[model samples]
Structures are given as C-alpha cells and as structure tokens.
Target: MTDKETYQRFIDWFRRTWWDLPESVHLHPMIETYLTPEEVDLLTNIPHSSQGIEEIARTKGMAPETLEPRLRALANRGMIYESSREGSVRYRLNDSFFAMLRAALWPGRTDEATKNSAPHINRYFLDGWMDQYAEVHLKGLRALPIDRTIEDKREIMPHEDVVHVVDDKKYFCVTTCPCRHRHNLDPDMPDCPHPTEVCLHFDELAHYIVNNGLGREITREETRDILKKAADSGLVHGVSNWKDGVDTICNCCSCCCMWFESFHKLGHSASMDASNYRIQVRPETCKACALCVKRCPVDALQLRVSPQARNKFGKAAVLDPDRCIGCGVCSHKCPSQSLRLVPKDQAELTEPPRDPREYMKHYLADRKAAAAKNQNTAD
Candidate 1:
C-alpha cells in the first residue's frame, strides 16, 4: 500500500474504534498536524487491543527491545495505554478520543510542536466532534450541589451528596478545565475569567492525568478548597454520568463547558440525559433576586410576576422544565432556597449510556431499525 493508503487505513481504524464518532473530512489532516509520518506508520502497527510485542517483533524480524523506544514513546505521549498483566507488560490504545485529544494538545511536557499546533488541533477537534456530534458526544457531567442548597422539605439522599463523592476518593488530582483552556487559547474567543484549576479528578483517572502530564496531583484538602471556590464562583458541580465509582468532577459554567457551548453556542443538541433530579421552585419562598437567573447555566429559571414575592423585585423564581439540564446550578445560587432538585419523572430521566462506544452501537442499531421501518411505510 502507498503511504497515503497506509494513513487512510489508520484513519479508518480510528473511525471504527470510535465507532460512534462522526466522520470529519478534516480528521485525517488534523491528525497529521500532530503525528509525524513515522509516528503514523508506527500507530498502524499497534492493534486496537492489548497485545505483547513478542509476536509483532517476530513478524518484523527484530527483537522487542528494538521496538522499546517506539513503544515507550507512544505510551509516554498517551497514545497507547500501558498495563501489567501477570507481571508482563502489555499495551492498548487509550479508551476514547476525548482522552486522545487532551494528550495531543499537551503533546509532551517538553515538546514544542503543540506551541503552534494547539490552535489547529483545538479548532479541528471541535469541528470534527460537532460534525459527528452524536458519536463524539460525551455523556455530560451532571451537576451536584451541597446539602444546604436544597430546601428543608426536600428529600436528600446520602448518595446524592457531592461531598460524599469527594470524601470517598482515595486519590484526587486538580487540573485546568481543558474546555476553558481551549477557549482561552483562541484570540477570537472571549477569555474565561473563571479559576482554571477547578477540574477534580479521582481514582485511576487521577493517576492517569498525573502520569500523562494532563494534570497535577494535589492533596485532598486542596481538592476541597477548589470545590469551595468553584461554588462561590457559581460554577456547577458535575460528575461524569457513570452512576457508581465515578472518577470525574468538573466545575462548569455554561459558556465554556463542552456540553453547554456545543449545545448553546455551536447548535449541536446535547446528547446527555438530564440528571435523576429536576429542579423545582417554591414561589412563596422566592426573593426573585434573579441570582438563580444569573447563575442558571441553561436559562432554565426565570423571574416572573408574583404577588407573594418578598421585595420590590415584584417577581418570583420559576422553572421551565423544558430548558433545565437538572444540573442544580440555579439551586446552588438561590438565596431564598426556592429552587430544589426532585427526582425527575423516572420515565423522563433515563440512564445514560454506560460508555461512548456502547452508546454509539446502540444508537446505530436504533437508527437502522428506524430506517427499515420508514422504508416499509414508504412502500
């Protein structure tokens, strides 16, 4: 095969691996922007799953030792994940393009390629994800709030406590929000004034970020401190959609978040389901301070005419279910505690797909079925 075919094959493999990802005509070129020609050839050598190099070595007519530098280079760049199995080292490609994009942005701790390529990479990556919006779509982080934010009459579950998730972690790492960082990089985009060191990582993910130069490991107390500041800034506390053993917490503002900006600014529909709880309003208690309105990331809460509103504001906080992400952002900011999170109509809040890959597979199947039915109807 020609070099062009070799590169195309690698791109095809990537598309198949990220099966849910939308096709970007510029994706292959964007990849070329980072990886050198030799590196691209090396990537084609690495299979989609974990494998030891001994067999590949024999096929290449060289010892695994000869490939060690290349293998280590790829692993250090966070392209392939390294693991130990039965005391032998094996490798596999990293789980998702989201992870790959970060590793690509940072390049290496010392690498200078990204100094200029960062802009191109960020722009192309955003475009690609938007083009194939669904496949590259993230299971959005669901916002969580402190117990004090809930109204006194509201039912608060121990499991629903945001701090509980924080306390349960054996490890923590703080990183700059990549979404915010990407925005700040572009001269055309408005700079985000929010604190940058607010991304909270946990467990194996913490270890991964620390090892990959994506984030710095930090003390638990520091982690808690950042969370506090994030709340004070009216940033939403969100965890990954995984219901159990969650590994991520992001303090998001609507302007800079991957989910919100894509939906609100870029015109891509948010593929994420709302959290289990939807926001509620007690008009009688509301001050209509519009604090919630200002803090609401999704414009879900509004100030409307109210006879019971306490001040000259002459309005009360009201929730529009159609607009709420169930993120609880408005609830966190309401001084009168008018907003509360209630278990969403279980029927309305369905479970998030376990992971992107499975989500894509299921999405394709559903689409195929729909298309077949439509064909029958047309006949």
Candidate 2:
C-alpha cells in the first residue's frame, strides 16, 4: 500500500480504537481552526517520530498556521512532545499518552503493532507518560517505609481492617522496586527489567480486599513484608491505603523512579510490570543486627544459625528467592549493603512469554463470552 493509504488505515484503526471525538463546541477559535477531524486523524496516524512541523504539515497538505497551534494543544494535553534540534522544532507522540490510547483502543490486547511489547507493561507505560502533577501528588505523603532500618513495631491490618495514622508531619513515599518509571532522567529507564511493576496493582487490590470486605486488618510490618515478597518475586511495588491513614510505601527501581526527574521522561501510571527477580544477601556482610530479618516484609528473610567456621557473622540472614520480589529495599538498608537485586536471567525479561496478539485474542474471547453471559442474565 502507498504511504498515504497505510496512514489512512492507521487513522481508521485509531478512531475505532480510542473512540476519541472532537469537541462539539470549540472553546478557543484558534484551537478549533487547527483541530479538524482530519488533523486529529493525521496526528494519530503519524508514527512516533521526531518530525518537524513543516515536514508534518507538508505531508498532510496543511498550512503551518493550521498545524502549529493544534500540535501545541495536544502537547499541552500530554498527548505529544515538542522537541528541538539545531533550532528546528519537531513533534512526537508522548509514549504514555499513546500507550493509553492503544490500551483503550485495544482492550485486552497484549500487543500493538507500534508499541514495544515488553513483559513489564506498567513500567513501559509510566516511563513514557509520567508527569509532574503525579510527582507532587505522591511527594505530599507522610510515613513511608523506613529504608535500611529495622523496627520492632511493624504492624499489619487484618484483610478488611485499615489503620489510620495521622502524623503532624508528612513524609515522601519512595521505593526501590523496579515498577517506578524514571521519566526525568538523562536516559529513560526501560520498563521493569523484571516483572516487579505489576505488583503495585495487586497491592492496591489487597487494600481493595479490605474495602470490599475481603480480610481484616494488616499491620505495617505485614504490609512491608508483602511488598518485599512481591518485589523479590519481581512483582510490582505497593503500599497500604494512605488517605485512610496507612503509611505510604512505593515500588521503585533505580533505573525508572519518578523521583529521578532530571533523567529521561518515564511515563507515569498506576500500573507496574510483572515481577521476575528475587533478592539475595551475602551472609558475611550481614551483621547479627537482624535488621534485614526483621524488616523483611514477606518473611522471605530468615535468621539462620551459623556454623562456627562459617560464622563470619554470629548469625546470617537467608533469602528465599521464590518468595522474593526484588524491590531492593533490603539493599537500601543493609548496613553493609549486602542485599542485592538480582534478575532471573534465565527467565525472559524483554520478551513476552506469549505473543501479544495471542494474548489479546484470548482476552477478546473472554470479554465476548462475559458480555454474552451478561446479556443472557439481562434477558
């Protein structure tokens, strides 16, 4: 097919997929002038590239005046990026925005033709779409997980029970889990190297369990342990409810943390990658202080009696990788930094276990079946 024909096909797909419609009434005349339905189609059809406005306008047969302002609007809405090279301004679709559109358009689909089909969907989305508003919202919290320390007073609420802690001071919730998408970095951190980002939702789901009457209270200690286990297992980072009085915890990674704003723009989202790695400790560096043993959120870390000859430390901490989530919280607190985040290199990190198309096919099938069931119930 000709490039224009191919482009038109993509536009049709985008329109059907996102179901985005132009505003019925234009609040701004300038915005109205540039944001014609055709232009919107063009914008959506354009590949995620660094093409200058002139090139885009020429390709679309649009005048500069007609294109520039509309592009600005999309940029302001976080749909695309405005970039410059050698005094020339260019535009590209924002990764997160496109990902959201793709997700919305291709619900239940594991893959898109244009998107990077990585296992860590959440991390990839955040790395491409995170914004400052999200950062400000997160930074305003108090009582985050204590990094690199052991506390005797860790608590867990029952499955459905929630504890509220009102502190005179607010604390920032940061994590060492790999789910965080580091947007403001010099180089954007790729999505979770492991599946650690997906656990955030599950953590939130756990809180929903409480809200929906699934379980009773869980303690702060228990929450930490759960997050640690998820991280070690390469699950997403998660925390208990914050507005309801629980301390805020984060799932973070050194590579893609939202807090690392100066780095490449990592998209922001409420999702995480699937976890794959686990945490390990060097016994020699582990002091009998039992900081890791006590701080472990998942109960994966245990204090074992050391043999006299083998006892570099009177006691050593042992880790069960199977139960670990690789959040790297242990690494942050180890007095010797003996804890390390290790990838399960044997497992696939960059590639999906199944084709995204196949996954999507199954997902669509399930959705269709569910819809039919609902229809039957209504009938």
Candidate 3:
C-alpha cells in the first residue's frame, strides 16, 4: 500500500473500532488531530492483542534494532499498551477510547502536540463525538455516590462505598481528568475551576496508567482524599459499569464532565445504567431550604406546600422519581435532613456489565433488538 493508503487504512480501522455510530458521520478529521500520519502507520503495525518484541519489530519494514526505539516512543505516548514480565516485552493497542484522548492531552513529555491539538480535538469531541456517542447504547460509564456523602446513617452497599472499593484493591493510581484538561485549553473561554487530578484507576488498570506514563501511583489514603475533595467541590462521582473491572473513579463536575452534562443537560436518553438508588424526601422534615433543589444535578428536587406540615411556614422539598438518578448530591447537603436514598423498583435495577468491552456488547444488543421490534410493529 502507498503511504496515503496506509494512513487511510488506519483511519478506516479506527472508525470501525472507535466511531461505531451510524455510518453517516465522518470522524477522520477529528481523529487525525490525535494520530498523525507517522503515528497511524505505527498503529497499523501493532496487533489489537498484546505481543512481544519480535512481532512488533517485524512491522513497518524494520528489524528489532530499528523498531524497538519506535515501539518505546509509541508506548511512552500512550498510543499503545505494553506489559513487561520475566524479561519479555509485549505490545498492543488495547485502549483506544478516552485512553488515547488522555494520552494526547497530558502535558508530560511530548505534550506540545497534545497541547496544540487539544482545542480542535475538544471542539469536535465535546460537540460532535458526544452527539454520536449519545445516539448509541454506550454504557461505558455510570454514576456512583461518594459513600460518606450518602450519610453514615444510610444503608451502604458494597458497590456504594467508593473508599471501600479502593481499599479492596491492591493497586491504584490517579490521573489528571481529561475533561478538565480539555476545558482549560482556551483562554478565550472561561475554564472550569473544579479539581483536575481526581480521576482514579485501580488494579491492572492502575498499573496500566502508571506504567504507560499517563498517571501516578496513589495510596488508599490519597484516593480517599481525592474523593473527599471532589465531594467538597460538588463534583459527581462515577465508575465504569463492570463489578470486577471497576478500574476508575471519575470525579465529575456538571460544567465540563460528559457523565454529568451529557446526561443531565444534553438529555442523553440512549444511555443505560444509572446509580442503583434514587432520592426520597420526608416532607415533615423538609424545611423547604432548597439545598437539595440547588445541588441536584438533574433538577429532580422541587419545593411545594405540604398539607401535613400545616403552617410549617413555607413549602417542602418533594421528590420527582422520574428525574432523580440517585447521585446523593442533594442528600449530602440537606440541612433539614429530608432527602435520603432508596432502592429503585426491582424491575428498574441495573445489572452491571461484564467489563467495559462487554458493556457495548450488551447495551448495543439490547438497543438493536428494541429497534428491530419497533420496526416490525410499524410495518
């Protein structure tokens, strides 16, 4: 293949792997900002599955001596994943989603390209890529409440405790959040002020981030501190859907985070897997302070007069079950102690996805099946 053909080949493959929306949308222009012609050629050589030096060295018309340095360069850039054990090297392009985006945004070593490429990348990613992502049943991420914020008096499930989740893991790391990083690119736009280095990773995923130079190793105490700081800043907490492969704790703010803004502001309906809980109110205890009303990400809380609390002066905060996603933001700040988390109806409870990879499989399969059945009825 010619050089242009080789570059286009990588684009085609990337579109297949990363941009799995409707065929009408074109992402090559946005994608090229992150991967240059040289980078694309290098990517086309690496297998999706991990392999050692011999396989990678054979690629791009180079022997091990010539290719080893190139492989190291790509590995350092987070373009590919590498694993070292027992004196052997393995390479693969395992993480291509926001992982590459994170690689391209961090201001570490070759950060100048990432720095220059960010605004174009952010514009399309925030506006265009997100629109496409929302159209698909991409259940790659979900909200999890900061366990302590949910009230010590409240029932805490194993999944509910973000700190417990960290303590359970032997390995952990923290990375500068990609969303916050992207938001700070433009001096013309007023950037968000929420904390940036709060994105947490665990286990092999933690190892993956640290080993690839994308993030730093963090202790369990440091993990809790990050979570606490995020909560204090009114940031929403989230994790990927898998129960076991729960590698990330995303501390997100509504102003810049896709997990919050896309779902709450952008009205993402094609998404799946919200928090396993929702908020309820004790109308009698509700002083109608509107703390919950203001803090709620979804505008799920509203104040209205309560008949039971005759002459309690004003109105009481009422729960809107349809609007609430059980993030625990309102409950944390409720002065009158009105708001609390309650389990959703059994039918509405979400079963966790197997892993990030399997999340798309199950979510897309269900969506496709639903669409087909709807079409049959229309016919």
CA lDDT of each prediction against the hidden true structure: 0.67, 0.41, 0.69
What stretches of model 1 exceed 4 Å from their correct place?
A: 1-6, 19-25, 55-62, 105-112, 125-128, 131-140, 152-159, 345-379
Q: Candidate 1: deviation at residue 234, Å?
A: 2.6
Candidate 3 segments whose C-alpha is farther than 4 A from its true place: 1-7, 18-29, 85-87, 106-110, 126-128, 135-138, 149-156, 187-189, 264-266, 270-272, 308-313, 364-379
Worst 10 residues of 2 by lDDT: 159-168
Instruction: Report the C-alpha lDDT of model 2 over 145-182, residue by residue, as the tens digit.
Output: 22322221233212111122212113322222322322
Candidate achieving higher TM-score, 2 or 3: 3
Backbone clashes in model 3, listed as residue pairs: none
User: Candidate 2: where are CA atoms >4 Å away?
Assistant: 1-42, 58-61, 95-300, 303-315, 321-328, 335-379
Q: Tell me, by TM-score, which candidate is best.
A: 3
How many clashing pairs per prediction, in order? 2, 69, 0
Task: Give candidate 1's TM-score.
Answer: 0.81
Whole-structure CA lDDT of model 3: 0.69
